[model samples]
Target: MFESIKYLQKGNQKRAYQAISELDIMKHLAAYNPILCGTLPIGIDIACSDLDIIMEVDEFERFEEQVRELYGNQQNFKVKKLHIRENPVIKANFWFSGFEFELFGQALPVKEQNAYLHMVIEDAVMKRHPSIKKEVIELKEKGWKTEPAFCKVLQLEEGDPYKELINYGKNTGFI
Candidate 1:
C-alpha cells in the first residue's frame, strides 16, 4: 500500500507529492525499494516534518556512492553510516523542492524497518482513535518526535517508546 506516492497527491500531502516528483526520488532509488515513512504519511506532521524515505540496501558503499552522485550538489547534502538498534544503516539527507528529504537504507526489507513499522502502527492507531491525531500533532509541535508522541498519548510510559509502540502494535494486532 505504501509503494507509490499517489496517495500523497490528495489532501494536505500535495506539497510532498510535488516535492518527491520534482526530485524523482522513487525513480532514482528504485533499485533499493524505497518506501516513504514517518509522520507525514500518517498525517501527524508538523511544519518541520520531513520526507522520510526508507529502503532495502545490501551494499552500503554502492548506496552511499549513488546517493552522493545523485544528491551531492543539493543544498546541505550529507551522507553517513550509522547503527540503529545494532543494525548498520546508511543515511543521506538534503534539501530539495522546498522540503527536507531523509533517505535511509539498511539490509533489512523496507516493510520491516522501524520507521516503516512505526508509521504503520501509528496509522492504525490514528484510524482506530481518530481524535489522537490532533494530540499527536500537538506533541510533535511541542518538540516530541513521532514515536514518543504516540507513546505519551497512549500512556505507554514504560521502556523505550519505540519498542513499546511496536509491542503495542503487535498485541493489538496492528502490525
Candidate 2:
C-alpha cells in the first residue's frame, strides 16, 4: 500500500516497511501505535544515527517480554532505561535479519514529542541549504551532534539552535 509513497532515501522504503511491520505486530500484541521519526526520512542519516521512534504506549514491560520471546535473551538486544522530565522512557537497540532497530518508547502526549518537532525543523533547514546534508554527514562522522552540526552549517546562532530552527520552520511554513 505504501508503494505509491515515495521515500527520500534509497533504502528507506524497505526499512520503513520493516518498521511498520514491527509496529503492526506490536499493536496486535500490545495495542500501541508507534511512529517513526528521524533523519532517515529526509535522507541525511549518519552512521551513528538511530531510527528515532516515539510511542504513547505504557506497556513497555509487556513489549519487552514479547521482544525477548521473539528475539531471544537480553544479551542479543540491549535496553537502557532513562527518564525525561521525570517520565520514563525505554531505549532499545536490537538487530533482526541484519537490520538494526533503535526504538524509544514512552507514554507522552503527541504535542509534546520533541523528536518529531526537531525532525521537522531540521528538514526545513536542510531544504534551504541542500549542501547541509553532506556537511551533516561529515559532522556526524566526526562525532558531532546533528542539531549543532545543522546549526553550524546553517549559521543559526542567535541562541538555541533547536529553537531557532523551529522558528525558521514556522516562519517558512515548513512545519
Candidate 3:
C-alpha cells in the first residue's frame, strides 16, 4: 500500500512546507512510511489549515513512547488514543511555532489508514476533477464539517466519497 502511493507536495504553501518539515521529524519516529495527508497535501487548505500525518509503526508502544518523548512536553501539546469505527490509532495535536499539527500513528498491519488513504485518492480526484477543488475550497470556507459529506453535497462523486475513493485506489492499483 505504501509503495503504491507517493507523497504529495502541492498544497497551501506554508502548510506544505510545514508538512515537509514535520516529515523530517516524523522520519525518526517510524521505520515505515510517514505520510502527509488531508487538505494541505492537495492544495485546498486555507489559512486555518492543520497538518495531518500518518505513520506506520512496528511497535505501537515504543513508537508512542518516542512520540511522547519528542513532543509530549512541548507547550500546547495534547495526545489521545482514538478509535474511529473500530480502527485504533493514536493522535497528537498541538501548536508548534503557531502551526496546528496533528500526527496519527497506525500500528502494524496498518488496517486502513483512512485519513492517509483519503488524501491519496483525493489527490487523484483533484487531478481528474479540477473544478472539484474549487467546490471543496468553497465548502471548507462555508465550514462544511467533513470531506465525505462535502463531496456528497457538492456532487463531486457518486456514492460515498470515502468508499468510492478507496475503491478507486484499489481498482487503479494505487492502494
Best by lDDT: 1
Q: Residue by residue across 44-126, what tens digits does model 2's lDDT show?
A: 77654565556565777876675557544423588777897578887677765445666677777533566667777777777
Relative to the unseen true structure, what is the C-alpha lDDT of residue 97 in candidate 3, on a scale of 0 to 100?
Answer: 62
Per-residue lDDT of candidate 1, residues 8-73 (tens digit) = 999999999998998888999999999999888777877889999999999999998998998899
TM-scores of the candidates are 0.98, 0.70, 0.76
Shift in Å, residue 163, candidate 3: 3.6
Between the candidate structures 2 and 3, which one is better when assessed by lDDT?
A: 3
Using lDDT as the yardstick, the better of models 1 and 3 is 1
> Per-residue lDDT for 1-175 in model 3, tens only?
3332234433336545654466456456546566666676567777787767677755667767877788787667887787765767778787776567787776643335777667766677677768777777877777763466445644557876777767766876656
Better of 2 and 3 by TM-score: 3
Please report the candidate that would top TM-score against the real structure.
Answer: 1
Candidate 3, position 35, lDDT: 61
The global C-alpha lDDT for each of the candidates, from Candidate 1 onward, is 0.92, 0.64, 0.65
Query: If the candidates were sorted by their lDDT against the true structure, best first, what order would they fall in?
Result: 1, 3, 2
Give the range where candidate 1 is weakest over 10 consecutive residues by summed lDDT.
39-48
